[model samples]
Target: MRILIHDYPGYAFPVELARALAHRGHVVCHVHFSATIGPKGTLARMPDDPETLEFLAIGISGTYRKYSLLHRFLQERAYARRLEQAVRAFSPEVVISNAQPDIQARLLATCQDMGIPLVHWLQDLYSTAIGNILKRKCWLLGALAGAWYRHVEKRLISGCAQVVCISDAFASEMKDWGIPDSHVVRIDNWAPLADIPVMDQDNPWSGQYGLAGVDVVLYAGTLGWKHNPALLENLALALKERPKTRLVVASEGLGASWLAERKVEQGLDNLVLLPYQPEESFAAMLASAKVLLAILEPDASAYSAPSKILSYLCAGRPVVVSFPPENHSAQLLSGARAGIVCSSGDDAGFIAAVKDLLDKPENAADLAINGRMYAERHFRIDEIVCAFERVLNHA
Candidate 1:
């Protein structure tokens, strides 16, 4: 099979998918566009491969142009020519897109022209009805981008030959959008638990970063709009009385200033922010931590998903989720007995839950084992990648 995967959550998903497909004797090609092309934007290099899969990335600079009537027209014209030509030349047997609506629509149309199957990997729900209502009040340019995103999103999903949604809740919303049941399949995010290293005394991060002789609760990922920093601040303040416990947040280029402001205002001495570390260092931090903190914005009830949950589980650390129960994140954590799931805005409950783990380190270890068992049984990267391979082959 000749597979082409569009970039969605950066190189992580694509790299996992590509490696799996290649191992199964399939030729894979991964294509991604530069997320940020200017000084304000940072670029991540897609590593090189000599065989099996070819990786192509393009850097383009244009904010979502919802309000700027002129910019919207320009984007439509530019992508129409550039992307159409690229898809035509790649001529993949199955074109799997990361659901950036317009690009998906173009690939669907182009593949239809060439008699190829088009698959849209639906990672999140972005609708005019919901996302627009929430973020519509952005600055003049941002507002424009918001409106443009709504339009492109609708057209793209509606045209795909198939949709690979990450959860049942997400699939249900796709049905609401008029995507046919036959065209959708549920495939959750996955990680290689086996790939994570075990913690030992000699590890660099074991006793470093103020983690030595402290009760460390780690949150590792992008600290963006999806994460409620206010909750983190509150958690920090609540833990201030626990002199030995520290909340260390490690991420890069995600609302750092916002976190800093809340930390200052709340006077959270236990809250520490660190820049992103390399993959090994990150794994070390996760393994060394006594507990993992997984957070979701209070408003993320529309879709129950978070990519970071599996990563935490794979690290074999007990999780403390700040999300609502009926939501997917909470359900997954509770089902695995991985950790405690706290109600949104339940400061008392959150505090009590953390205290329970701190007071019962043995129970915390058991919870962490449950999480690792779940990851090995269900969320293993090899299992998920193999499932994705079947999707591509059958497409």
Candidate 2:
């Protein structure tokens, strides 16, 4: 069957998923926006890509990620046109829409007119996110905009042949939006396991980064605004007493820059800031970590689940997540016994969790084994793509 996988640009998972489908002997067209104008990611800088699948590149200048009124509407309208034109040209057997709810909502009518089946893959709660963004400036405007978004989101969700959510909580949100449970398929996020194998702490990659003997408290992905930058600084301060322990951040963004400044201000000699590494060293970087960190501000946890956590699991490293226990990330880690979960507000709890792994070195290796086993069962790329293909074919 011919399939179109519409994923936001720069996300590696979608590219891997598209390749898997193409390898299965299906004609696949992967649609993406201009990565150069948006956030930096592995897919954007990929030295090479597969020739098997068709790439529908939509040239978008100026990032649509901004919250400005003019930019949002203009970008949405422009992308809607791009998507319509691309779909008209490709004529795929099925359409799997990923991110950008506003653009996808506009295409729903077009898909109906063309007799094409639409499957919406819910990676995040875009409507709720818009509501949060707007409410930060004006309450009444936020409410009105949120209601409008909900109305359109319902139309998009109900119209789709299938609704694929990245987490159980997101799938539950679809039911709240009046989509039946039968229509929702919950597929947790996954990592490209082939490229990121578990490595030993004593590997040469650790020595390359001067991490041979240092105990690295690593935050290895984009340190975005939604993640409280102050928390990382606080963790650094907490670890100051341990001369051999250091906080290693391999990321570049607003939050990362803030942490770097804090390192200077607070005289945090243990803080090590570096630019994002190439994908080839990603596994070794994680392996070098004594304990990995994944954090989300309390308010943003409901609408988002950082895909980086899945990659951390693949590296077979002990993870320390500062999220609410009720949240999906916390639940997954706690269920697998792969890491420690400390509520975002509990500084003492977070500190103790980190210190425990340091004090009792055996816990680190145990969590690493548990994490790798959990990853093998759930995050294998072949299994994730096979599940996605089944949903598309059945839809």
Model 1: per-residue lDDT, tens digit, 1-395?
A: 88877663343545667766766777776766544211111113335433676666654456635334467446645654566676777777888877445556666778888898888887765543245334535556555665777667756777777789888888887887787888888997766555564564235685667577778877777665566666677778888999988888876544556777778887877988887666546568788688888777666656447767877888888888888777777888899999999987787787778888988989998998898888889856667877787777667
The C-alpha stretches of model 2 lying farther than 4 A from their native spots are: 36-51, 63-73, 202-205
What TM-score does structure 1 among the candidates reach? 0.83
The true-structure Cα RMSD of candidate 2 reads 2.7
- Expressed as tens digits, the lDDT of each residue in 163-259 for candidate 2 is 9988889987887888988788988877777667888776887798788888999987767646787888998999999999989988776787898
- Using TM-score as the measure, the top candidate is 2
The C-alpha local distance difference test score for the whole of candidate 1 amounts to 0.70
Error of 1 at 232 (Å): 0.9
Which runs of model 1 end up more than 4 angstroms from their true locations?
34-50, 61-86, 128-154, 206-208, 264-267
Q: Whose lDDT is greatest here?
A: 2
TM-score of each: 0.83, 0.90
What's model 1's lDDT at 345?
A: 79
CA lDDT, every model vs. true structure:
0.70, 0.80
